[model samples]
Target: MDARVDDKVVLVTGASRGIGEAVAAEFLASGARGVVITSRKANNVEAAAERLGEPDRVLALAARSDSVDDAD
Candidate 1:
């Protein structure tokens, strides 16, 4: 659980809900400078970012996890 994430940017894919959302929240709790959360739908990711409660530190991205282009 020691992430060493202080002031670091973390990316969490499939983060619209469930474990992915939890992991992203953990990164935020661990003092990550920012969390970039990705989901296939913009609305879902945006909602998740809002629920995380740190607008300045969270970015919602719509992406297909299976897509290499999206990964880029």
Candidate 2:
């Protein structure tokens, strides 16, 4: 597949697991320049980012998906 997201930035919620994680991975594979991943727990987000193995390209943030304040 082509790197459609080349040089683009992506934000992914609930990225600790499931479909969100998959989307994040796909974005990276498609050549995103940066990816921000969020989850309710800091530890889970950190772990997921670590597992993604692209420290310079990935950022992990803790935020509740149901809360608007957290999203800000």
Candidate 3:
């Protein structure tokens, strides 16, 4: 672990699982101030967030990357 993210906010897309989830976890492990995870499936991202096990430090949002509305 390093101070690379000491107090920085991180946004990880497609984070419901796979590489995105791993990245989000790493950010937390590396000491990020907070992490915002997004995915097309609401349930999936929410579960992924919970799995990260840092409720206070993680925010999960269901958003389709290709959707203009979701982007907003």
Q: Give the alpha-carbon lDDT of every model.
A: 0.94, 0.91, 0.93
Q: Give the winner by lDDT.
A: 1
Candidates 2 and 3 compared: the better one by TM-score is 3
Looking at model 3, report the run of 10 residues with the lowest lDDT sum.
Answer: 63-72
Deviation from native of the Cα of residue 72 in model 2, angstroms: 20
Off by over 4 Å in 1: 67-72
Candidate 3 residue 13 C-alpha distance from true site, Å: 0.1
Ranking by lDDT: 1, 3, 2
Cα deviation of 25 in candidate 2 (Å)?
0.7
Report the C-alpha lDDT of model 3 over 1-72, residue by residue, as the tens digit.
454997999999999999999999999999999999999999999999999999999999998775467556
- Pick out the ten consecutive residues of candidate 1 with the lowest summed lDDT: 63-72
Off by over 4 Å in 2: 1-3, 67-72
lDDT of 3 at 70: 50
Q: Better model by lDDT, 1 or 2?
A: 1
Is candidate 1 or 2 superior in TM-score?
Answer: 1
